[model samples]
Target: MTHGFRVASLCLSLGLLVSVVACHDNKPAAETRPAANVDVINVALRDVPVVFEYVGQTESSQQVEIRARVNGFLEKRVYTEGSLVHAGDVMFVMDRKPFEAALDAAQAELAQQKARLVTAQANLDRVRPLAAKNALSQKDLDDSVGQEQAAAAAVEGARANVIGATLNLGYTTIVAPVTGLSSFAKKQDGSYIDATNSLLTYVAKLDPMWINFSLSENEMLDLRTQTQNGTLKLPPIGKLEAVIVLADGSIYPERGYIAFTDASLSSETGTYLIRAAMPNPTGSLRPGQFVRIKLLGALRTSAVAVPQSAVQQGPRGAYVWTVDKDGKAQQRAVETGEWNGNDWVIKSGLHPGDHVVIDNTLRLMPGVPVKANLVATPPAAVNIGGPDGGATGGQQAGAAGASGPAAANANAGANAGTTAAQPTAASGASGALGEHTALYFASGSSSLDAQSADALAAVARRLVAEPGMRVAISGYTDSSGSQAANQRLAAARAATVRAALVVAGVKIERIEMRKPAQIVANDPPDKSRRVDVMFSPAAGG
Candidate 1:
């Protein structure tokens, strides 16, 4: 191949050509060169926080099954369907004929017993004096006393029977125990029913409905520990505010509180139950209703985050592509943490000033040219303490580059914020660099000799003194090796220069690295293993 030039005669010509092209054309011409299809993003800083969301159901605070206290037929149902009814409100009535007749019989028995008692008492009074005077046998007085005792016992038995009968008669009328909306009676009116009334109706309390949800055992422990340590604060009982999201996509106006939390962990399901109370005075939030439960308070301050679109998947791991001074794409390996709603929390491999690709990268790859657009105003207001708590980790974590439709649209602007490699051409010697100040290299190597490293170091030192100056380190490799291996070689060379700058005490934010760079190949040794470092004005300068 005509790549990896091993000589010095052509490097000067190549550098001169690149400079002329940069000055002559405002756009990249070779960027359209076709290769493997891919997308890219520029690494940048953002605000990210931790959040969580869950699905739950609405339950009545109090629910009871109304049953019959006595055996009888249901006479009437006093409450209307789906209407509020109070405790002691009549719910049903049974036939009263049997109980009423029983009461009357007991009354008659008690009256007869009373009359007999009066007669016996009179006989006892008359016989007592005779026994004392010896006018009659002592046995006769004893018999009178026994008769009076028997009559008194009979009266007491009759009174007990009357009380039992009256209680049974009262059972003929049934009523509600607590106030709530009444459901359809289980058994029809005028139907014979016994102690088992068969769930006549359900009365659900709505003023303060309970929302039941569960959290994993691990999560429970984490929460407990965090609260105790003051890292995570628990919402106050009956004080923490919450909102209800209905199925129709409308938000409930009233707020609620954290009512109760289960003390014991459930054995069947390794989780703890939580009951949050919500206001439903208008009766709009009905029982048996399903809803999305969300916690409304608490927030983290000035967190670091990035749009999901800025991250991508690579053969080695997740990555983000950034731009160099000349607009060439450079890939960097990154460690991604959990996603916070529409963004991701970057654990490593990025900084506050480094630009991350945020646009569609269907045609982008290592060494490809690009243009990035900076986003001044975000599309949506900060969703602070809002319902979209956080992203639930899933299979998508492995596929880093694929973004949902919403994420793609939200990050379109950053598509214009990338680094596109410009054609190199010799420029007028009137600026920061001398006319001969251009990149040179040894053949087919990523190792920068002491001379090259020192040259780049001097440039970095000068740029450090001049804030807002930029020097893009573009690495290249000969086509003698596989594309993947060559890409690594190019990247290693760029990384080498970056390390030197950092060692020289260059501001970390001012240095950018371009990898698997735009190739300038031939038989020459000086240009093959070189990193083409270009000096230019800082972005938006």
Candidate 2:
């Protein structure tokens, strides 16, 4: 009976062991799966600006050498080193005793000559009366008159010497020749300075500081081809707006404009020279300051743009990882133009509705399946207008009336054109019905670049298509220069734009030139210095 009971217990234990083994073999598959997630943005088809960013350096608009005009010992250093000074302001003072003595001697010499002239004149007067009364011969009277004339000439010579001496005395004090920041003095106090060749110091004009940059020959050729092919359009020569990016990655508060462009490429560097003028009211920007320059007033039509972080540069060139319809990431080679802030303006290799991987790029591989989470793209720059979809009066009104959080976005739209109003995110409403573009200009400049011309051509076509539609062209200028000058410049720019529109086949009477109620100061000079063209719908339609 005991043996039978033990056998039954052993069978029960075996059954329990078998059930535990089966449960271990049937473990859940959910906990072991890997998470394949990535952040991405959908590539949208729209007009992207053809902005060119180049590493540039700041230079003094004008460099004036400070030199001593008179020879003397430097008595005192009146100006502090590295200080600002104005024209005709005293910078240094030399010992004036010697120059004063010289002037006194010249004056004394003139007085002595005057006394001699008086004696000669008295003798001449006596001789003249004697000759009249036949008491003196003709030769005697002539001699006395000649003596008087010689004495008078001596006095005049002495007077000229006194003037020279006086000028030398005044030169004892060295003064600034221009209004600008001063450099360190080369000649210290008590140092003997040569009148003709002594170098004291230099003063550099800081306002309207010059920023010079260069572009390679190959890049220039590529730009030319792009323009000729209608892929890239640039603003006119004077209208190209510039902005300075400092070494610390901060944009300068003051705006800049293109001041000069080289006529020919340099053989040594194989690059063309480009110079810009930046306002330096506070002397924050100095000569020789290394900075980055952004050239606006250019637009790229029908170009695809992606976040700069999404693009990767390799030995073969630039490329981005795009997600396919099957949810697999694909590596694509892309042609890139310039950076519009954090976004890369892709000239080629992208299409609308394409998904680009922005984050987790390192973990991605070609053909690897990914779960793409659409990320919101940043707002684009304002004032970069497109063909038919530019800054219109209606858009401006929408921006003007935008309140609270939307005001910033609206103002951005006002500056850039209608693109800013477009959906920055992929999940938002589709893009605006038409393509609008805005072309910005530099301070006190109305000249259009190639891009501006293209934009204007596009606007002209729209006007021609609709006969009743009229455009209101308004010009503007920065507050760096004189107010009256800005007004004139703005007016001239408006008129110039009007003339171009007329030449493009738009009726002259239909285009209206309007003036703004107030010109805001201390704003982004590029945005402030622009010609806004607000389109009016067809009157009869």
Candidate 3:
């Protein structure tokens, strides 16, 4: 009787579990899952700016080698090594004794030749009258005339020698051929500078720096193909702007233009070499620095683009979620090109009027119903690697309001729901003086560029306006070259800043030169090579 009761209880429990399962399965799909809320943007075709990036190297437009014009002992180095030197600045002084002696000898020889010419003329004067009267033979007069002419010739040659000697003497004092940054002296003091070892130093002209970059064959071909098919439009070569990004991601303030392009590709690198001329009036940029070059002013006409966040990577390839006409989420694969600011350039797989889901994409799946809200599309501007939508290394191009009827229409459509705000300056004079300002230097150099000098001038003006204001300067250097050299360079950089401030009317006593903080070994060269100037109101601080 107990076993039969237990079996009846088990059957009743199974029936209740089955009934619960059937009720759950019978529920509507709406109760189980609802549509995902997503923010979508209507895709549009418009002209988009493209920036072609390449690794470039800085070079001096004029790199003059300072070599000895005459062989002599290097008496002394007049200019400091690795310093800014003006044109005609004395760089080296060779031993003047030897050249002086040679000049003296030449002058003495010239005087002797003049004396001989005088004597010869006197003899001819006497013989010419006697020969006309037949008092002396014609041979004597002829001989006298020949002697005078020969002596005159000797005098002319001697004068030429004297002039040459004077030039040689002047060569003993080596002056800079051009205004530029000088290099280390190759021949030290007291070293014999001969023809084989005449290289004394070199001076690299800093203003109007040259930047060299290259393009591969494939890249050129692709660009040509696009241009032929009316897909890419390039501005005039001269109008195409070039901007450089330093190693630490800082944009060079100056912009350059394309200067030259090689007709034939380089056989060695198998690439077409191109060069840009940057006006570096401040001498901030040095030769041989590898920087990123961005060439702007190219446009991709009728190109489709989407926000970077909208693009997703899957096992197959890059894809984006789009809302279809049925209000269902559909996965569309996309071929993406380079990044245009915060947006990704969609090469293919998208069309105009397509509602691409920019937000709430992660929760989406194919065939899932989505509640889509239209959002304004981002402006097509090149603002890569910048915080404030400004181009970090290049000028902002292809803005929504850029010239063209198509671009204007696209701009209007994209900004229909939003109002753009203008950006204001971040800091003013009072605010700038309260914080530290960094002055960056070129590698292994202590000379202040135009920008640095301007910064110091501002600080000087502030200090003059406020009597209680004081400044402390600290210098730093990268781990390149030698430790001793780096230390010296750092100290020199600090001293340069301090000196500039004093020259700008800031009291020397109010300025303090602080030791640089310890730098990491892996720090970037651009970040390491800088002088920090901190302002204070306290005298001791």
Candidate 4:
């Protein structure tokens, strides 16, 4: 074949053709190559949430430092270290002999003072009567009265000493001030501790934990702008909800509301500090654990969104390659908004139901013929916090990509649901449709690598074998670049999978591209960037 191509090239160069028709026979093989297959998604008008994600930390709701209330020698720890304890639970047992002895001495002193008071009172009574009868001087009665008063005063002072000694004795047994989880003891047994300066340990209330996060000045300003322009509507400050994503990619099951927000921004960081309270009755969430706080409430209406990869940057701002009616790639400049998961919110330069190319832009150019394949964006997994304050990870179904009539219909459904707050454990979304398997994509491109291709191939084979089955595809991208670009990338990934399935002999008529209810926002970009492929038995099969 190489020799034939070379001979043809030489013949054309020598101009040894009998006619124009004969010269056409020597056309180069490269010129006759087929158009590149480009993955595409249909853009649609849907309500994109105005979401803000921030790094946050989990802290104890109430942290109490344990200390010695009275100076004494530490005898023994009553409760186990790092154990849960209730209010009034004994934490430590100090040496009580000294306090006990002091209390006994005070009691004896009080008894002695009471005896003296009795004698003085008797003397006063006797002197008063005698003095009244003129058998005793008035001075004697007055002196007796004074002696009785002094004895009573001494008795009162001794009683006060007894109460003090009793209180000191009771303080020897240290107890928990609140119900919480305890830390290890800092002072060991037999250690001498001062009442005012000793720090024994700490007890932290963990039932309702605090999630601390900050919103930067730029984010705050952007939100205000969007709100003022009517692009976004925020919930009442008190009604705002907070969702926490733990370090292990699981969400904290219980929903937390904003407990407090700083009135002013911090001068050091130029950010407003915020705190949310999440119930951690099981003590699964610990203090100092890093987490991601998802503040839900702001809603964006009539927002156009696409995969981030579909958007490309250039000297003329950001643009995406779209397939025209003639199956040719065309460049469309676009304006973008904040990222909602892996997709970008397109503010302008695109309309609903516009086809946007999502993948294989490395070799694509404007006006070039493209084998545009319409595909649906993959369903993104929505891991909501479970009822038990743990993560229940599941995939959401019916995410259509940015392509074909299916996308338009899916967008309509999505728009209908946008008016309500995002669904969660507390929002009655337990019975919504969910996906079982997820399709993932590669970095920076929509073209499938070997692993993803193999996974898609299996689905194609299943579709070919089951003629009555229909599949739904949804695309997604990671938050790495401009929102427009990521949206485009997600769309392209969905289209590429559809093209592959078509090449494997599956009928295009059975495939439906879908817009996911939510976007998958995972790490490694490759994991978050994906196309979901779900199969269902055809109607009346």
Candidate 5:
């Protein structure tokens, strides 16, 4: 009986242990798992100022090609190459000895003709009186009259020749027609200049620089659609303000206005060209420079925006995490538009009063419980710091003492909704010097776009700062065109980059050119049209 009681107690204990384990397993998951903590903002509609940015090239308001008007040997180049020249400034001098001799000969001929006219007139007066007195015949009087008339005509012709010769002499001294920047002399001193090879140089007016940019057909259509739907409001073309961001990310101090827009699209590029005129009293802006153009005075009415960090890209498209009425995390697909400072404009997939998760989004999943900490909505408008001072359409006040577009943009990102720290200009330059910088080009074109120009500018600055650094440049082209054409284009693109670097004060010896290999067949055309610049230390030595 003692053994039986022990077995029964043992069995009871074993049963209790199993029941305890099962009870632990059956406990509700809600009590074990905690809701994800996230920062959220309630969506609302407001009018936001929209700033349109484009890569534009600076052009001289008046670019004139200086050429010789008369044929002669170039004797001397008077003006310095690449120097500013005023209107009526002597630029070149041709051989003047020949023209001077011609003028003297013509004058002497005129004098001789005048003397003959005087003599003929005297003889005619004698003949007329003698014929009236019957000492000479009527034919004699007529002959004398004809001689005087012929002499007078010869004198007139000689005088015209003298004037022509004088004008020719004046043409020998070539002068600048406009006050502007002068280019290198095409014909050197002692070089023969003729009608076929008469181009001397160029003069580009520096004041009131023109900024040219193009807009694609798709972009125009989308803008029109937005306007028709009451989503976008644009100011009058003349009232639209323009601001330029230089290659170094500095804003041009002077403001500009929209000067022109093409009525028809270009068949070659399939885009419409737009131009702006910016005052350049200091002559800081030059022709053929790539710059960023910002067009302000437009607004997006009743639009929803979220911090750029809130938007995440997925396989389907861009999406954001949102909180539902039941406090569960749900993924919402959204259509995004242009960026206003640090905030992104949302075109669809969100409604007013919806909760958007701005932080701790990585821990979110469909139907997962979340603890939403409500936060203030991002600023409606990015303070661009222009003529209006952010007064139009809910633009926030710009940072105090922020000058130029770079400073204003930096402040805008800070105050609007930027979550990450930005690198300073010094740090950015250092980073650029340590890596391979790429400059892209348009299809079948060797011209550098604004972004490429900016990159090259940075590279040039680095080259200037570090004397030991050398650069290796390589060009590429797509496989769509003929192989020969592609090869030529690649070479041209590389040459263009090298020229730009030289213009930026980089020595030609420090730059190494590399021949481009055939690009992969599947590479995108846009990706293929590029020039890569790699910097190496002590390579120059």
Candidate 6:
């Protein structure tokens, strides 16, 4: 080891031994250790989706209640219960003795009247000749003509009565109005049932069952916005597919389609009713059976996400650990949305390529050395970011344009060695009330420099000057060692900064500490370990 800021020696990991030749003119230069970490990006953006889900029950397209049409004794049912029957199929037969007798009597009267009409027609035929010859008195002939007309009218009335009686007898037999499944008849043999009695049964058509559901106004609005922004995707037209789930949790294989939608919203529920038609050939589905409808909407636009472990709460707000060039740890603030379990959906403040910690959260830091398991990331994680095949992003553009974690690691290694220009950074400060915070690391660790205390002290001074101002610091480590070690180191770095602030007159109550980011790398994860501080109320003024 060389003393006084200029010492250089290297240790090799595997079993490689090599020595460098001594230089004759030694004007010493600072030596740098290799960084084993990678760089990564995290960003925040809204990912909208077009969702279709609602609960509904199966219903028959047509149903009819069977009732009696005439008063009579209960008769035999022509069809079995729950059996399909065609239109005009007889359902019940009633006693028709009284109607049959009335028909017979009317027919007999019509016969007697028809005989009179025949006699009158014969007389009129003879009288026409006599009137021309003047062989009979004109008054006598006219009288015969009047008698014939009366008999003809009586015969017509008798025929009409006969037809009415016949129809009355037919009404004793009940028929089905439509083709459908007939429920059990309520009227039994020997029971008196008629048009005025209780319902006999019901018939329902079951070939194409209807599924009804509702959609709220808010849901409709969301769908419209997604379509406009081109974020959420759209499926086929009336061909929108849906899954039916019964109460048992098993998936229904049969597919259903959108049959119709209500024209207006319902005032009671503030929703519009939608109906889907499903084929039920075997009649496996019953009318009014409750079921859940699962519909898959269009795809979503591209989005980047990182593990919750990678994000830290700093004075400025929320940020993540990013490995920069030279394998150094850097704090990057991030905006995020929903929690995707092991990962966080970054809404803003992240980019395509970014190395993020996924496992061993306790060992992550800005500049601490970390070793990524090297296991390829998975692609299909139920809307997860990427796949081991290197395919990621929900949106096509995101998948095509986004960089993988490997690229981020490479970038971090390149950035770790150089520090940002201090003068330029300081000059960017807006005002006296504004405070700036920078991460520090352990000696030779880059994870969090032992000098973090000095940086935090400066933050403390700024906070006191601006009483209402708030500050946040995020810590990170380089990927130079084990991920576990890096996380601890990263956490310690943040604690040190907070301690420094406390000693510098900043209140302990005002400080907050957070979990470390898992940066993967065996060498420069140390550089990735760091704490980023932020001020509230827009800082300065």
Q: Where does model 6 exceed 4 Å of error? A: 1-51, 78-90, 102-168, 175-179, 228-230, 233-237, 297-541
Task: Tell me the lDDT of candidate 1.
Answer: 0.59
- Please list the residue runs of candidate 1 whose C-alpha ends up more than 4 Å from where it truly belongs after superposition: 1-52, 114-157, 195-198, 225-230, 236-240, 297-541
Ranked candidates (TM-score, high to low): 3, 5, 4, 2, 1, 6
- In the range 1-541, model 6's lDDT, one tens digit per residue, is 3553342233342213322323423548778554443334333343433224344566788888887766777667778887888899998777878779989999999999999999998998899789879998898689889989999999999999999988888877878887777887777877887556847888887777887655445445555665687755666647676556654445566877887878997653345677888877777776655555545444446757565556677788887766544455556787654343344556677776555544444445666654443333333122212111111211111111112342233223212211221211322122232334556454534233323332333344355444565655555555565777767767766765665454333566676564554445453543374456655554322
State the lDDT of candidate 4 residue by residue for 1-541, as single tens digits. 9999999999886675466657687786566556999889877766665444444566789999988888889999999998999999999988999999999999999999999999999999889989999999989888999999999999999999999999999999999999998998989999998966589999999989997765445445655766798777788876777887665456678888889989997653344777898888788987755465666766676678787788889998989888899999899999765444556777689987788989999878888898989999633222233211211011011111122233233233333322111222211112223332355555665545434433443355345434677776666545556877777777766776666555344567887776432344543444556666654564111
Question: What does the lDDT read for residue 207 in candidate 4?
Answer: 84
lDDT of 1 by residue, 85-178 (tens): 8888887777888889988998899899999999999999999999999998989999999999998999899889888888888877777878
The TM-score measured for candidate 2 stands at 0.52
Q: Which candidate has the top score in TM-score?
A: 3
lDDT of 2 by residue, 377-433 (tens): 665654322211222212221221112334344333223422332212211022221
Model 5 residue-pair collision total: 0
RMSD of each: 28.9, 24.1, 16.9, 22.0, 13.2, 26.2
- Cα error of candidate 6 at position 507, Å: 47
Highest-lDDT candidate: 5
lDDT of candidate 3 over 1-541, digit per residue (tens): 9999999999999999999999999987675587899999999998888776554667899999999989879999999999999999999999999889999999999999999999999999999999999999999999999999999999999999999999999999999999899989888899998899999889999989998765545456656767899988999899989887775567889999999999997553345667899999999998756555678898888889888899999999999999999999999999776566767788789999999999888899899999999989988887534222332111112111122333233223212211111112212222333456667777657755534433444454355445677877777756656878788889988877775555333567899887665467676557677777776785343
- Write the residue-wise lDDT of candidate 5 on 1-541 in tens digits: 9999999999999999999999999986666568999999999998877787555678899988989888888999999999999999999999999999999999999999999999999999889989999999999999999999999999999999999999999999999988889988888999998889999999999988998876545456656766898988888888889987665556689999999999998654445678999999989998877665678888888989888889999999999999999999999999876556667778789999999999999889899999999999877665454222222111111111112342334233322211111112211212344346667887756777654554454455456445677877777756675888888989988887776665444578999887775667576566677777766674321
Question: Of the candidates numbered 1 and 6, which has the greater TM-score value?
Answer: 1
By lDDT, highest first, what's the ranking? 5, 3, 2, 4, 1, 6
What's the lDDT for all of these models?
Answer: 0.59, 0.68, 0.74, 0.67, 0.75, 0.57
Q: How does candidate 3 fare on TM-score?
A: 0.62
The TM-score values for the models, in the order shown, are: 0.48, 0.52, 0.62, 0.55, 0.61, 0.48
